[model samples]
Target: MKIIKFGGSSLTDAISYHRVKDILLREKEDKVLVLSAMQGITKKLQKAIRTALKDEDEVECIIKEITKKHQIVATQAIRDTEILSDILERIEKKMKRLERLLYGINYTEEVTAKSRDMILSFGERLSVHIMEGIFRAEGIKSRAMEADEIGIITDGEFGNATADLKHTRKNLKKTIGQELDRGVIPVVTGFFGQSKDGYTTLFGFGGSDYTAGIIAYSLDSNVVEVWKDVDGFMSADPKLVSQAHFIDRLSYAEAAELAYFGAKILHPRIVQPLEPKGIPIVIKNAYNPDRTGTVIEKEGYQREDVIKSVAYTRDIGVIKIEGVGVGCKPGVLSFMASTVSEHGINIKSVITAQTSINFIVDMEDLEECYKLLRKKHSSAVEEVVKMEDEALIGIVGEGMSVTRGLAARVFSAIAEEHVNVDMISYGASKVAFYLIVKGKYIERAVKAIHKEFFKV
Candidate 1:
């Protein structure tokens, strides 16, 4: 059996639904289908939640728009009147429940983590119903199963939760195993799972890919196929470097590094569960199924070019703490890092010197992080600096640590572009290394590096 997951881009409209149906029909293997919400629906749901705090009328309007969007897709995709009616009714009921939840938030003027997670879950719940209808219309035996119902119990972290795989495995083997044996495809909702306390909790955004990995690990399936709009992972973002080409293969470590640093192809956490099981992940194009997309495995095919990709992101900032004997001060770094994390901000990387410490974080969290550290350690810290316009560039491959003078080539390419490097890091992961540069020079740096290494 195989675990097949479709991203939001693959289920955007009526035509897209038909394409997904045809793809499933062609697969003869016993497979489980995992689905994200239709494109833009999750964003709209988030919008509704924010609007609920201030304006209930705008929240209602957004809910109506969501209702109309799903209704139209169901009408266009399902030919049988009965299936269409059932799906439309289910959509209406779910929307009504969502509306009530939003209004509760409006009345209270506060959004708890639990309520927020429940509100965000409507996207996947609604899409699963429509997809089930689509499959049923074509006489395919399938059931629309919510993640919670089918035993994806999480650790109860409201915003970002990890599945309790041991319990989940037992529950799934009992629930999903029987269905697979009877040849019934379990069309399960991705993204959110139920906590042990029986409340809805989400994995982070773009977490549907993580959901697919968890299911594959539990079942020990043959492979996990992720269908997206793009062909697969590329050597660089084509928009930044026009010469960027497709990467046909990548090791699991290489893929994880790429995703973590800035690659949008897969979620950073996706490789966690799959790696231990040695489950190979195939990234395929939903629109063009005939194309052989990139495959990520334990021992991936090595390229002639040692560096598989140069990935970069501008969504980063640096927080510099400078004081006399700051690095020598006991527990100062630990105190500051613990404070930031306690407030739910993630530090990407930390660089320290004799008298200074630099904390790298998401650009959006820079202000709050600086404020917190300043308030907490005013006497111990002489100055706190927030550099919000920094970009991170990462080079990922299997043999990077063993390769000779590869770092020199990378620096030479960037130096030719006359871009100044702010900070550099290495040896943390043998498969990858990253450097920081000014945001303005990121495109030039990426293009130059891609050209030098790829020689395209």
Candidate 2:
């Protein structure tokens, strides 16, 4: 069975919904439909939450807007006027109750994590209801499902909770199995879940993909297709590099590396389920579904290619350690690695000189990384300098290590464009090379590499 997810833009309105239905209907086999909240429902929900917390208007306006949008699609899709009207009323009432709870949260002088989770869950709640009605109206065998009903229990963390897979899989398997057997397409909610204690929980922003992957993997589905606005993970962020091309495929590790370093196209946990089960995910375009979007697999593509994608992250921390006694000490490097690791910060890159070693990490943990290492050996080391704002633009490919003079070509490309590279790193696998430079020069660096690799 295939688990198909329609992202926000794909199911934003009546027109998009109709197009999505056509796409699903065209498929011949049994499948499940996972949906994200409509394009702006989540944002409106956020605004409403704030208002409700402030004892302002109960956010009835935003709820009404959502109601109206869903109703318009229902009017076009649902042939049974009476049934559609009843369903619409049920949805509207639910929204009103959601608004009341938000106000009550304000009334109580508190918006507890548990309460906030339930409030935010309304986005997916409303979406699944509307889609279920649409499917039934069109003579499709489909049912709406609340997230909690399928056993996706998460931690009590309000904003960003991790999935409890064992429970999730057991519960979801029964529901999906029943639905598929009945030839019914179950439209499951994204972005929200419940706890072992019955409290509502969420899977964080962009966690919907995580939701879809979890479901797909647990149910042993053949594939998970993520339909998004972009065609796929591109050579670089299209907004940053206009000429960037879509990457056709990637290994799971490579995809995770990109996501870790500010790549927005894939969900961070999308691969977690696949990693253990060896499931493959296809990142396809909603706008142009047939395009060769990126396919992620457990195995690296055996076919050789010169380059894959040029990706970068501006949220980077660069620290230079310079001291007379720090040179060639047996324990000096050990101390550096151990201290940083203890802080739960991964060293993105580490470059060593005769008397210094410079390290780069994700910017958020810079202070913690610095403080831990500094307290232990700052004075003992000699001179310690930290560059807080820097970026790492990574040139990735399996062929780079084998490509003769690949390092020179990369540096030459950056030099010809007058871009400065402050540090460089290579791994034992020799699959990727990362260049650290001034954060402001990231775009310039990416453009230069893009031309060198692809434009050449």
Which residue ranges in model 1 land beyond 4 Å of their true spot?
301-304
* Model 2, TM vs. native: 0.80
lDDT for each candidate structure: 0.90, 0.77
Can you give the lDDT of residue 218 in candidate 2?
Answer: 81
Superposed Cα RMSD, model 1: 1.4
Q: Clash number for every model?
A: 0, 0
Error of 1 at 403 (Å): 2.0
Q: Candidate 2: which stretches are off by over 4 Å? A: 155-157, 239-243, 302-306, 313-392, 399-409, 422-436
Q: C-alpha displacement of 293 in model 1, angstroms?
A: 0.7
lDDT of 2 by residue, 166-241 (tens): 8888988787788888999899998877878888788876778888888887898888888887777877777777
